[model samples]
Target: MCSVEGAKKLAAYQAVDNHIKSGYKIGIGSGSTVVYAVDRLAQRVENENINIICVPTSFQSRQLILKNNLTLSDLEVASQLDICIDGADEVDCNLNLIKGGGGCLLQEKIVASCSKELIVIADYTKNSSLLGQQYKKGIPIEVSPLAYVPIKKRLEQLYKGEAVLRMAVNKAGPVVTDNGNFVLDWKNFDQSLDWNKVNLDLIQWPGVIETGLFINMAKKAYFGMQDGSVKVQS
Candidate 1:
């Protein structure tokens, strides 16, 4: 039997197939869902001769490109990209996204912004009536390791919430991002959130390089729904 996750995965796979094409320099994204898209792209490459170079959002994403036999290129070399496809943790109606659940938000946003087109692929559960509804985790904010305490205090005083510094339990230290920064997992707000305003305010705080809230960036979003259907929003 096809599980619910499987159904959504299939939808994501199909959605990417419909978007990716020949003569396109692709941006491969991070996370588990993107893995399926990579696999599908590889299959197409094996069947047909296509000249495509993929830039990755993170180390893991780069490995996926290699493991799938897709040609890989550096972001510096290929300054322009035709399309970029990635998965989101949560997607609001306006296509605002909560990414970096995989801890690659900074790099992901950089690669996506450099591309001409960005296509977000996510499962049904990721879709939300509004931001902060589906994903309760306030937002993933990457900060300097030394600035964690001060930044956390500011987030609490200013944002009216506690910012939890994400710890690397396995490594017995702080979670280090691909850019050599630490992530603050801010959560548990005491009151209702004005997502648009809050997202903007958080980034203005000092010591914050970037936040995981991707607002008005995606050109197209492919939401994989239950019962094997897809919801498209532009």
Candidate 2:
């Protein structure tokens, strides 16, 4: 049987192959799955001699661009992108996503919003009938470091779910985002709640920089199945 990592690679390669073009500005997303996308994009740049500029969504993504020898640019230089290829922690039937598992949602969402299209690449495990069905890590909310405690309290009050600070595995403190913000993972949200309203309300809270809830943002998704096949969702 093909491993889940293989599935991620399959989906990523397929998405890049299908969408990447010469002289186009691309948004490279951050995650394990997106590593394959960047690698494939670099291959295309070398083998096909394509002229492309890649805008990174995180520190890791920026390193990937440089390591792969791909042309690196910024959102300022390429304000509007042709396409943004990213991975999601979870994706629902309607294409709503739970991102930021890697702590890069702020830039990821910003880059995606500026793109003409957002294409998601993931393994089959990430596909779900609804949000919070597949991913149990909770919805990651980036917030100001100073307001972490207040934001956590407010989120718990609003959603009736526990919002815990995301701590670093190797460090003694919370996981700091590329933008130097903190993250709170909100667990146990009501499954049947309206996500659009929830997203709007969460973002309006003071100190909330962004939420992991990417509602109605994805234009398409490619999920690699266990059987070594790819599924296209739009």
Q: Which candidate gets the maximum lDDT versus the true structure?
A: 2
Clashing pairs in model 1, backbone N/Cα/C closer than 3 A: none
lDDT: worst 10-residue window of model 1: 187-196
- lDDT of each model, Cα atoms only? 0.83, 0.94
TM-score for each prediction?
0.92, 0.98
**Alpha-carbon deviation at 79 in model 1, angstroms:** 1.1
Per-residue error (Å), model 1, residue 149? 1.1
| Model 1 stretches with alpha carbons more than 4 Å out | 190-196
lDDT of 2 at 94: 94
lDDT of 2 by residue, 148-193 (tens): 9998887788788789999999999889898999999999888878
Which candidate tops TM-score? 2
Clashing pairs in 2: none
